[model samples]
Target: MTRLVDVVVVGGGQAGLAAGYHLRRRGLDFVVLDAGAEPGGSWRHMWDSLHLFSPAEHSSLPGRLMPAQPGRTYPDAGHVVEYLTDYGKRYALPVQHGTRVDAVHRDGDRLLVETDSGTWRARAVISATGTWSRPFLPAVPGRDVFTGRQLHTVDYRRPADFAGLGSVIVVGGGNSGAQIAADLALEGDVDVRWVTRRPPRFLPDDIDGRALFDVATARRRALDAGRGDTGGVASLGDIVAVSPVRAARDAGLLKASPMAVRVDRHGVVRADGTRAEADAIIWCTGFRPALSHLAPLRLRGTRGRIATEGTRAVDEPRLHLLGYGDWTGPASATLIGVGRPARNAVREIAALWARS
Candidate 1:
């Protein structure tokens, strides 16, 4: 017999868990279907040393507070995982771990979700998978010909992974690139090169005590323009965007521009006729929207990412999307930033369910 649920949420991370918990609080019937063996999807896979950029106070899920530490900065990835696990236990949120959802299909006013475990039917769905489902790799010529190891920021576990490498080239100007470069530089005489197609912009942390307000203004502008694309607010990308060149220069990681680039499996040739060599290349260029698992739901877009008008649900109206990169105008893509949009989605879903 196919089990029925009011709403079947995919991806049991902070976003999914928040939606599920909120639904439960409202006495709504729902089930959270997660892909990981436990909660905290990417947090589980994140680099060991990675910590939340947001304060712990802002990082907690619905109805629960993160373990408090007065005047603390942020919690590490492991701490995030622990908090999520405890949240499930505390609320008894119905989440099936290790249950990888393959496809979600609409079966006449209901959604039939296929998974590795079993099939579930639900009247609605909340996709809380978030943006990091897949890492985006850029196509650089002769990329495979390089004899050295290459990795995406996603696969980067620790600086120890690159410990012995004498020289390293970190691609992209995102926070990941900057932090990795900084750490590598700190680890003895390791040569780190940061390659960014264009120079990144910078904003100082302490500028008349209005740094926070400046960022808030930018977000508000994005929201007003209807492009609530999060992920660049304080992310590795945003941090680097503020002044990557300066940061890299100060760390001795900056290099001359390659005006004309040609890869011969050894080095990058500049358009101004200069060659720079690298041992390893780390591409933090960014990621493409991952919707392979949702192949069945033929959404109206080039990628499976459904383009929305305001916050309206696409593809299937009953099936709502939360954290579908750029779907939530201007709030940023982090869990803390995604809360309001998720709540808004919940309210809209509730209204739709009530009408149904």
Candidate 2:
């Protein structure tokens, strides 16, 4: 028999849990379907040495503050995992773990969520499947011909995996690329090269995710007011000078080169015709939204995103997207940012249900 719910949250990560929290407050019957074997969402898959760009107090969900970890300025990945697990348990959020949703489509007025476990018919569906599952790699010439090890940020777990390698090339300009390059440089023997399409933007030493979020929030407010642009505002893409990154910069290892023109059997070949022999290459090239499950709905817009006003889809009124990125809501991918959009989406869903 197909289970029916007022809402089905597709993902059990921070965003999904946040949606569940508000849905419960609205007294809606809902279930969160998570593909992971356990809780914590993408935090569980981050590299071991990863740290939050913001402090614990700044990184939290809707109802509870993430308990601060002693002696750490920024909580590590493990701390985040523990906090998320506790958050779900604390609210008794109904989550179906290890359930992979394959597709979502409309069955008349209700939406049908087809999963590996079974089918779910819901009055509304919130797709919070964030980007971790969709790591992106640029199409570099001869990439397939290169025989050395190649890994995207999603596959990277630790620098030790590349220990003893002669030379390694870390690609991308974002925080992931900077952090991974720094971690590999700590090994002290492997020749590490950082490559980016453009120069990396390093925020001031004192600036972190908290400050960046504030700047983004302000920019959003200005845009809402019909202001033309907020050019001076900082972006979440700007790298926060966390300790390790600072150390790398101090050691002069944070310097970046332009992206390579191609990859050969030996290593990366730059536009200048210099080939850096590399034993391995780690691509921190970022991720795309994990929205493949919504293919049956054909709701994709520009850049493979579901066009939405706030969190509600423009084409499909009952559909909402959360935690994907700013397109959904400002800073919505962050722990603290997810709450606002989740609340807004759930409120809208509740109102629609009431009218129905």
RMSD of 2: 1.3
lDDT of 1 by residue, 61-177 (tens): 667878854444667788888888888889998998988888888898788999888888988887777657688877677677777778888877776777677777777765676
**lDDT of all the models against the reference?**
0.68, 0.91
Per-residue accuracy of model 2 over 75-104 as CA lDDT, tens digit each: 999999999999999999999999999999
CA deviation > 4 Å runs, candidate 2: 231-237
Worst 10 residues of 2 by lDDT: 229-238
